[model samples]
Target: MSVLPDPGASRAVLVGTSQYEHLEQLPAVSNNVQALADLLRGPLSLQLPDRHVTAVENPVAAHAVLGELRRAATEASDTLIVYFAGHGLVDAQDQLVLALPHTEFGRIETGLPYDWVRQVLLLDSRAERHVVILDCCYSGLALGRMSAGTGLADQAAVEGSFLLAAAAETRTALAPVGETYTAFTGALLEALRQGIPSGPALVDLGTLYRHLRLTMEARGHPVPQARDRNSAARVALGRNHANLPAWPVAAAAVADAPAGPDERPWPDPRAIRTVTGFLTALADVRVVSGLTQKAVSGRSAGSMTAGTVGRLLNRPDLPATWGTTAVYLSACGVPDEQITHWQAAWQRLRTQSAPAEAARPAATRDGGSGKPRVWQRPMSTFRRRRDH
Candidate 1:
């Protein structure tokens, strides 16, 4: 199970604007901010100290919010969390801006540019991990910018950072009438309070995101979108209260439970010698994990990406680096022991391919140097090792 952040070393900032001078007011935004602060500080969740959690209500200027974030960023050595609940505006360039209490619709200069938040988290912060949650319309753009276009490799995303948005790129967040909080934040509060049943011992951000996505989809609301770059996916925000002691066994026991329909205990790595066989084995690990490519990438801790995972899995070729395979397996919940075995196998294949490539004719090696020579295990050996 994932451990909670140390209260002493972690800092959180919650900013909300419930009242706007010229635009529509969101009274629920204030509620959202307060409730979340309580959860983060209370025993139910992270249980952080009151001094560590800062809640700014109805800030009149952008600097007020940024100042809080900057302070927390410097003070925190473990984790830093920044949350915003208010109207989200776009600048002339369609960049995200957090609307303040005095900001007007047409006059976006009065609002706080989302980049201020991003830059501080990306460049200014000293914390080991970051979690930024935005509650507003068109917030998915923030997540989109966190990564370059998905590709096989060279995805330079920030490590140990996770961003969750209340709405997708094109949709607007909802604040239902008579509700104490906005739709997005209300569901979040519910998840933190009630917990997910039969979930892991602690409620991780990835698991929490999954629950929110399902809840929003069922309610016909704008489903929240998330981007997790590294170890942030495993950060446990709170204990799973709904997962009671009715099953008093260890957390490891749950993981060792019978496989779901999508999972299988695949063949051993020692039997895989060819690129196709290695790829096939990797795909099997993914099936056992039952996580989406995006989810797997989200937890890879800067190793592989969703596009990279998809590209490598679907292709007949092997990965460009061991980092790709290692992260994929780690993110998919494969044991470190198994991963070490797989790594040896992958290295053995690479070693074999180098010699074969050198020996191959120029035409066979794809212009003599560009393509990797595919590895193949003898048919007799493969037959002897076939799974039952």
Candidate 2:
């Protein structure tokens, strides 16, 4: 007798919305949603079984679209519903709203909350598997105001649903500004494209999270997060699992992994000297994030150039002529709030310094303080001094 595959296996719905009436209002967000949808239908298609994917694009009918999701959830064997890319807003009651086209304004007003999705997944106890991936901002807005540690149900009820939201309540979910992609959805695509499948061969969720954080940092964006009952899921990996995509991190990009007690070697004294000089000069220079005129002058401090500093701080590398004002503010330490404060401080310093910089007369005089005000001076001489 032939062995039958597991009875209930797979089905999915992918929803993407790009066009919005108020293009000026939320163009970036809409565009990102569309891009993520394209990826889901194309390169990421391998994950799901053929033809099991249903995509609804730019639907004018919100109720009908949601009804379809409901139908898919109820009718499919093992279902995964992915809503990739959209801007979400919370109502006065803090309920999350998934936007539809203009016609369904009334329904949107009383739209389904995120918990509704969770409840749908949890209700069917007989279903072997369910996954909901929501890639939108203010995602937690609909999930209720309960703190992170709060139980899924406010009344301490247990639910089997596994949820993966793109970001925490505090972090702003970013839309692709230009070439960039939405941090949340972008990370998801990268994970699906490159994550490891451990057991019988499903893509490993833990590894995906690890890659997501690392990729976001490299792309000059805040990392999206993941929360779920993964350990309890005990998802089995099937054989001949998907392979990771090729992503290159330049040799210079690697930061030595944090040292363990036994493995830790003393950092090179020269690097320490370089870091000290850079920090001292960096403290004096100010760099603002959105400001147009605030330029970062890449001068030499330690081994890193001013350009390197600008890139490190996510600032533009201005000419060395910008003087001390060009120092990009990227404080290196723990406590992220402190880093943000320093970043703001740098901007203010840059603003204060810009005028004084213009006021300074052009060079007609000799040896007036060889210091360029910014630390762009070459480190060759400094190296010599350190050697001595």
Candidate 3:
């Protein structure tokens, strides 16, 4: 038997935004998030390691949640999981839109696009297992659509990383009867709790999709459908490497503090200089990495330039809320493992930084490292490897 390595490197970010004071607000969104947390931290907890879980509530810390998730992907972890419970919309072109906490007046200006999230997930180079379970309206966008536009029921298997959206783009994902669980989340919980038994089944992508549909229908709810469940059409971890300098340590000696109410605090003035210095280092890394052959190829026929990706990493402009990052990263294609890596790094740095001078006010910048950092790699000499 081929023994798979321990998934200790794996990490999950659960973003559940339930309260929306706006007209687009859906109360069940929060319920779905809480239920998902219970599922992961409860019965599914046994399947995952103890240290691999981080659950964020409401919209306050969504961006921080996403930054952490991005960091996790960069850590070269083997598995990354992201679960989101909220309202999902689509653009005029039928693309997906993940709504945030303060999304208001049905305006597209306040939403996060699906394409952004996809970019985030594609950042991880070492993840062998990636799963995104999004229980939102028209979430099928999370799973790339079939280019052929063939309506025939198709299936995809999960090898390294895969996504499971709550509903297909054409369908409206529904909420469950009790405990604010969405139909998709409810079915997923059932499958995780009783679906995966002590058996020899591989629990491949097809099986998981089938299980999800069967379990949902069995419970008398709308049947769950999956897009790009076929192994032929999944996300591939690319083989791009950069010769960038080592990551700088002690940026403002920043420390990651617990997510609490009114937690607005500033970094140490001393650490600010360090953060500025690291930002300079990151800028150089991006320039050199960009000069190299930075190419990204995925299972889907789409490819992105390393320079474009480097911009996503370095650009720090964000909404002034917690869940915005999670929503944005989910939209960006940033993987969950990478986010966890950053969270770990943030925590470590936070420990070395000064204490909270005041409540962390709502700001686009987290007052730490403003630049997105990445390793440098060339696009040349990047051949698809059948085995690592």
Top-TM-score candidate index: 1
Residue 147 in model 1: lDDT: 13
Q: Which tens-of-lDDT digit does each residue in 1-388 have in candidate 1?
A: 3546656578899999888786666788888988999999775787676899999999979889888888999888878888888777666766677878888766777888887777888888998888878777532233111111121011212457877777543433367666888888999999889989767757888999999999989997767777887768887787777863433233244357676552224335865545655765676566545567876776776677789889878875666578778878877777777889999988888887887778866535554364433345566655665542
lDDT of 2 at 263: 20
RMSD of each: 19.3, 22.9, 22.4
lDDT: which candidate is best? 1
lDDT of 3 by residue, 56-159 (tens): 66655335556766776665355566676676655566565566766543465666655555566765435555666666654323321211112212222233
Please list the C-alpha lDDT of all candidates, in the order they appear: 0.72, 0.41, 0.45
Error of 3 at 91 (Å): 1.6
Candidate 1 displacement at residue 101 in angstroms: 0.7
Kindly report which residue stretches of model 1 are placed more than 4 angstroms away from their true locations once superposed. Answer: 139-159, 169-173, 246-388
TM-score of each: 0.59, 0.46, 0.48
Model 2 score (lDDT): 0.41
Give the alpha carbon lDDT tens digit for every residue of 65-136 in model 2.
666566666655533444644545454555555554342233444344555555555674334455555555
Q: Indicate the worst ten consecutive residues by lDDT in candidate 2.
A: 264-273
Residue pair clashes in candidate 2: 96-142, 200-237, 200-238, 201-237, 201-238, 202-237, 296-318, 298-306, 299-376, 324-374
